[model samples]
Target: MSTTPTPAQEPAAQEPTTQERLAWMGRNSKKLILALVAMVIAAIVVTFSFSLFSSSSANPGNMVGTGTMAIENSKEGIAILTVDDMLPGDAATGTVEVTNVGDAAGDFQLASSDLVDTPATPPLSSVLNLVITDGATEVYNGPLASAGTIDLGTWQPDAKHTFTFTVTFAETAGNEYQDSQTTVDFTWDATQSTS
Candidate 1:
């Protein structure tokens, strides 16, 4: 009879005991915690990334703008005072209406420039006297040569003032001032008020 080789039998598997299960679990606990931490971080990142698409808009009436400062006068291009063939003790008076036409308040001022005297010697401007008044308040009372810049005080928007200008040929003027004439240009200036 021919003898056949018999195959080796495999051993039967056995269930793990309670102590072995506990030990296995303790070893794998760190991996479980790490996996849970990673999952939570991913969730947080996704939540924050969704916020990037959020947006908002302002109201239609919400607007920004700027203010303007401007000034004007009634007698824009007219002469305030004129006297022809003026003699000693002669005077010429004129009235002008100055107004703050701008929407903002400002400081008002009066200045004189371009004084032309026919004869430099015994200049007529030296002997000519100027008296400026606003109501009862005298703004200036001096010779034309000494009148530099006069402050008319602060003015509000649309405010008006009537200024009286009286120019007199000094009575003391002698023959030296005869036939000598003086001309000056007056300027009205306005600057935005600080307050």
Candidate 2:
């Protein structure tokens, strides 16, 4: 006789059908919808708060900038002629301390010329008709010798001479002297032949 067939094993319970799932969702739909709505509101609140903080950090109106401008290789003791407060003005004062730095005698002179239209509009040159005064005498006869011209008309090396200029707006005839900033941009001719 054939052995009794083993009891048929029931298949694993399958997932619920779509219709069954929909029926279940219909009963609990309100709670599910509320949960979804709450999540969306939380997401919107977090996004708005982050944006507000980011905007303040990126505001350019409250930013500050600090920059500087300068010149290089200028001769010693020579500085721009500026106003009393060091602001640009119509007049300036500059002083120069020249040294021979060469073996043979050096001959350098301060020759100033008037400048016409310029970047700062002031008619000025790197060179100025400096009214050099020694104690009380206006030394205008010879080139300022960072050295005293003793018997020979020459500058000795390793010697230091100082000259001061009280720059004024009244230059030579017909010079259209503008603001003081123009005097700051000047080139010096320190070409005394070095023997």
Candidate 3:
């Protein structure tokens, strides 16, 4: 008797449909994307950790110290110049000593604030003349209100410099400035020299 072949013995193979192919692709793509994300996150964490460790190691034993450079004025803080019952052509003179009390050499500059008049109507600084001298050497000569910054050169540690200031009132000043008084503030700034 002859035996018939079973369905399992068939040689022809059936191809996958479009839906099956699409489902397989979807599953594989999800696994691939998840693997890529995990790898990226791990790389970022490693890079950040490396940067933190390297930066901390680069500046090992770095320390900072606190110090200061100070300058002292002869007047302590402010210098008062008073001219009472003054007439035209009257003049006054004052002296100040500037010393570097710090441990470093420094360059100094002298500046003056704008002249302030008691009576705003008549400006007394207009007719006032100011002259600054360092040991007979002229440092500045002009109107008090118009004076700008003046370089006083450099001073070594524990060095001192004396300055003389002369104020004069113009003879051309009129009665408008009779009761008007003007005041000026002086500033001394010292900066550490590079050399």
Alpha-carbon lDDT, every model: 0.88, 0.48, 0.85
Query: What is the Cα-based lDDT of residue 29 in candidate 1?
Result: 95
State the lDDT of candidate 2 residue by residue for 1-195, as single tens digits.
Answer: 889989999999999999999999999999999999999999999999888766334545686764322112235444444454222233456665545555544555544444333444334443233355433445553322222322212455564555565654433423343333333333333334446
In Å, residue 151's CA in model 3 sits off its true spot by 1.2
Query: Which pairs clash in model 3?
Result: none
Candidate 3: regions farther than 4 A off? 1-67
Q: After superposition, how far is residue 177 of candidate 2 from its true place, in Å?
A: 7.1
C-alpha lDDT of residue 31 in model 1: 93
Cα displacement (Å) at residue 125, model 2: 8.7
Candidates 1 and 2, the one with greater lDDT:
1
65 Cα displacement, candidate 2 (Å) = 54
Against the hidden reference, what TM-scores do the models get? 0.70, 0.34, 0.64
Stretches off by above 4 angstroms in model 2 are 1-78, 84-91, 113-130, 133-153, 170-181, 184-195
lDDT tens readout by residue for model 3, 1-195? 999876676677779999999999897998889999999999999999888856333657888975557888888676736677878999998898889888888888988886688897778888889999988799999888887789988888898888898889999999998888888888889888887
Clashing pairs counted in every model:
0, 2, 0
